[model samples]
Target chain A: MTSALGAGLEPTLDALRARRSGIMCKHWETVEAGLCIGEVAGVDDVVMRADLAHYACRNNRLAQLGLEQDQFAAAVGAATSRYGRRRIGVFLGTSTSGILSSEIAYRQRDPHSGALPASHDYRHTHNSYSVAAFVREYFGLQGPAFVVSTACSSSAKVFGNAWRMIAGGWIDAALVGGVDSLCLTTLYGFRSLQLVSDQPCRPFDAERNGLSIGEAAAFVLLERGDAAAPGNVLLTGVGESSDAYHMSSPHPEGLGAVEAMRAALRMAGLQPEDIDYINLHGTATPSNDAAENRAVMSVFGAATPCSSTKGHTGHTLGAAGAVEAVISALALGNELAPAGVGSTRLDPQFGVHYLFDNRSQPLRHVLSNSFGFGGSNCSLVFSGAAP
Target chain B: MNGVRLYVDGIGLHAPGMAGWSQGCEVLGGRAAFVAEVPPLAAPQALPPTERRRVGLPVRLSMAIGLEAARQAQVDVATLATVFSSTGGDCDNCHHLLDTLASPDRTVSPTRFHNSVHNAPSGYWGIATGCRLPSTTLCAYDATFCAGLTEAVSQVSQTGEACLLLAYDTAYPEPLYALRPIPHAAGIALVLAPKQSERSLARLEIVPDAGLPGRMEDAALEQLRTRVPAARGLPLLQALARQQPAEVVLEYLDAFHLRIGVMPCI
Candidate 1:
């Protein structure tokens, strides 16, 4: 994973353990609105390989940076050899999808005719499927590939997608993840919606205002359950739902969120009590945190240890699901309970076990929630390979 | 990947010259001439007035085709699961939003922002049909149609439930047009079920194959196969158009194509 919190899992885990945050005051070029941002440091310095020059863009650059980290490429290569490349599918999620490249191109259009600059490459860059195509080429994999762009829940839904294909006897294994880069549209668009915070977001706090937009890239490899198990990690269950109640806002009572969590638990054949840790989608926005709190309380009864890592990494948009999925795995593997950092005082009224400090505990199954615009909602249950 | 077979129970189509299944079948069969102008999409009356007013071309096109497929299959729209695929979702809306963001004001309208999500069409489908089942939106550039078919087939096989695959693409306005160059709008909706039913039209199975897929017979339709991402399903569409057992291939990914073997059961 590459995110504002820092690159790779160790750094992100270390930051979470130290209760550190990566958000800073808004400073992105062309984003003048007074809002905070979780900028992935040194993205401009990351360069794409010459062979894959056609896929060069901020999004793919971040994806390459992510692949280089934590031996992700090596894992993919091993899977390629086992599955023969054609048998492995590539499923990724993203929102902006290199629109920044076009945003830049739009500025360079001819003064009079408005003709875009000759250098524009929409297929390799701005298209939503660009990242999946780039990853497929980067690894030389020939399997089925596509991009899921359902807002923040994009990445989480890919797990369900891969599960269906693999379980239905389509693909033996799959590469699933998400990558979203900071762009003017998201920063300004959120600001226009008044969902941008002036300072680091304080998720689930009474004074919680809005979200701090962030960017990240995270990937995972999934082989059939019977295949050689790479590690002790397993994606046990996934559930998806559409609120159908509103466009940008979630269902007021979190109807979709409740159903998604319940459905995931049902699919995993586990009860809510089996979940040792809950990674809240807590975007720090007033509506999101409140709605999620109600949904969590109704499901877990305010007893389960829960927190939002968004305080550390900021809300990574489409990548938030996979980033948090990794965070859930890290917490289980390291036997640590991540805390909601930015919230100095948890909101007392909501009455959920909102953690504000890290603690060591024996973790087993963990659930992560991701909800997005268009009322798209997804919940995933991940388990350790141990008893 | 294993071969997952699904029965195509119903089909809905809307394109420049094609309007519905019968019309599309006629056009694909070379019995009718291709028209250059795309048919105008009507605002979906099934959707609430508010949502209907807020949607753009993608939503309108998806709803029109999806409802038609559901109606033909005699399936309750409220019980359907959907996968809506598009190369560039609501390009006009994107262009409008980008144009607004580029200006000094930089504040995007709420309606435009909400409708900008790729799954906006799926959301409206849920509202119009009152379906809460899982729905996913996908994009694979020009491979979007094949990807959607793969997903729909997998969903049907995995869950033993019927699934709807809606593939559509719209032309981008000027600046984006220079890059994508989609000359016209096109969309296809298929109702796929796990097993053959009274309404089943054909049994379809997709397997991986080497090289590009089969092409349309006419040059104009062939141009559509290249221009519109959704139109890449022309081979399968033509097979269904003929209402006979046929083998067709679809472009899926680099170095791989989806070889679809269709056995008509109508």
Candidate 2:
């Protein structure tokens, strides 16, 4: 039963009378307009674009933030203000810290002595903690500022860190987010693993190829219930688990994945049936989809509606978890599920329910899952209800 | 509380000075710190130039530290868990990608993209060591010390399998290097055991400080050493690894301060 709003153009709020609550995805990106949407070969309109690495430095694992030193500070200005001065801390997650800068320096070196070029700036922004430092100085945040680079699960862990701080009475507010731009290093790295999808990724599709890499910078304002404004979503729970199975593959049984989901449910004091929707960490790769689907079914049975937004956004790597989390919060507040843009036919392999097209209704609880290459799994639960 | 168990059973480090745990540990007294010098690769000629070009400092560091610790802990690849952690991950690679894309001509290398995933080091560790047991990588901002330790403890307790914990961070590259990080320390702490061993080395505990609020990882490490006279750990967690017969205690402050209780191997 959903709520009725203005004659109920969409599902009415009353329709949710017996449903209790659901997770709504509000502001979500279905595809990139300016650039090619994903890794498809024949794009009708990608007015302007270039190959993944031709765009930047290559080979080296570490790379700098593509942002101008000061520009990064400016980009986070609004967020710094929102979190307040003393209470703000910067949490960043990355896979490579400053490999690109090193690559450029390596290329420009005095090849003979292996010395860096005169133009090289040794203070590479690609260092893991640079973003936190930039954000800290950007907003003059005096509190503890740091970065988390846990492979794919990097940013997802940021939510866990922030929630604990708020719950444990650390800072009154926190600036939690992630930023990563594409680099040849990442492209080539994934290609080396034979995991990069040559075409735009199809997350749960049986015919899915691989992952179409993408990049983004996103942040969310996390405040306590006492300090939060009306309609602000509550960061109710964060669950983290390690597979200790394979470095790049999830347990075939989804043991670690299930543990993480269970932990989040326990911490939130909620049951699987209590969740309204799930934002999957579906990378569109055959392995990831297979593993994640098994895990989702293991937990949600078949009733919980689910969708892998990665098809629409491409796997943003470090930024994927945070961006999806932001989208989840927006959905809860607006009570709308952004239709799955790329998913044509539901993957027959996965049995969970998916919202077709776009729909508006009452939403309360949302579970966002971020599973990285190392089996570092984090599930963050966001709630819209007052409690 | 007699015979507080503390032993440097296995240690792995990635610093400018050395890559082996025994070598780095002997030099630093089991301390994790910034490396001032990076020696030439031990097997420079063995690895193809492409392999050298493909690997980053962290991955190189992980290999050096991982193999050594594997030897020290008598780690069997078939039955082990590894924890990989860094305050920041391959940002240099990410930045390069961004700069390239932002440039008039956007082109990033395919090789670099693969290296950009946070799990690169762990993947390489598995590839290099042929260790298939489960593994994970984590980032806790500056709290890498506590977060890495907690995850390691949980793995050993939950799975009861041998686990290798590697935590390290390198200096930021340039343009960005002009920025600041107290010190670009390449530190790796390895904790191991088989399935919550009946024979515990030191019981690690997380105690929160209700009064202090959110402190950094170092503070938690410092408090644990302070609470227990012999429970001294350096680089924040060195104290836990060195826990003595005395009731060793360490405190960690994240969003909330956690007091870690370590039960030394008797």
Task: Tell me, by lDDT, which candidate is best.
Answer: 1
The regions of model 1 sitting more than 4 angstroms off are A228-231
**Docking quality (DockQ) of candidate 2:** 0.18
- Candidate 2, residue A113: Cα displacement in angstroms equals 5.8
Measured on C-alpha atoms, candidate 1 has an lDDT of: 0.88
Q: How do the residues A1-387 of candidate 1 rate in per-residue lDDT, one tens digit apiece? A: 989988899899999899999988856877665668888988888889888888888999999999999988888888888779788999999988888888888778798989888888888999999999999989988878899999999999999999988887667889999999998878877877889888999999999999999999999998876543444688888988888787788888898899899999999999999999999999999999889999998999989999999989888998999999999999988999899888988877798998887989988899999999988899999988854
Q: Listing every candidate in turn, what is its Cα RMSD in Å to the true structure after a full C-alpha superposition?
A: 1.4, 10.8
Q: For every model in order, what is the number of clashing pairs?
A: 2, 118
lDDT (tens digit, per residue) of candidate 1 on B1-266: 45668888888999988888888889887788888577888989998897778889998899989988999899998788899999999999999988887777887887887788888898888778778788999999989998898888888887889999999999899988988899978899999998889999999877888866788888988998999999998889899888889999898876778898899996
- Which CAPRI tier for candidate 2? incorrect
Error of 1 at A94 (Å): 0.2
lDDT, candidate 2, B1-266, per-residue tens: 01111233465655545445445444444355434465554532223455555777677766666666666566564455677776545546655665554444445565666566667777666545545454556654445555555556545544445567776666555434443232344556565664334444444434433344222254533343232211222333334344443332332333333344445554
Model 2 residue B113 distance off true place after TM-score fit, in angstroms: 6.4
Highest-DockQ candidate? 1
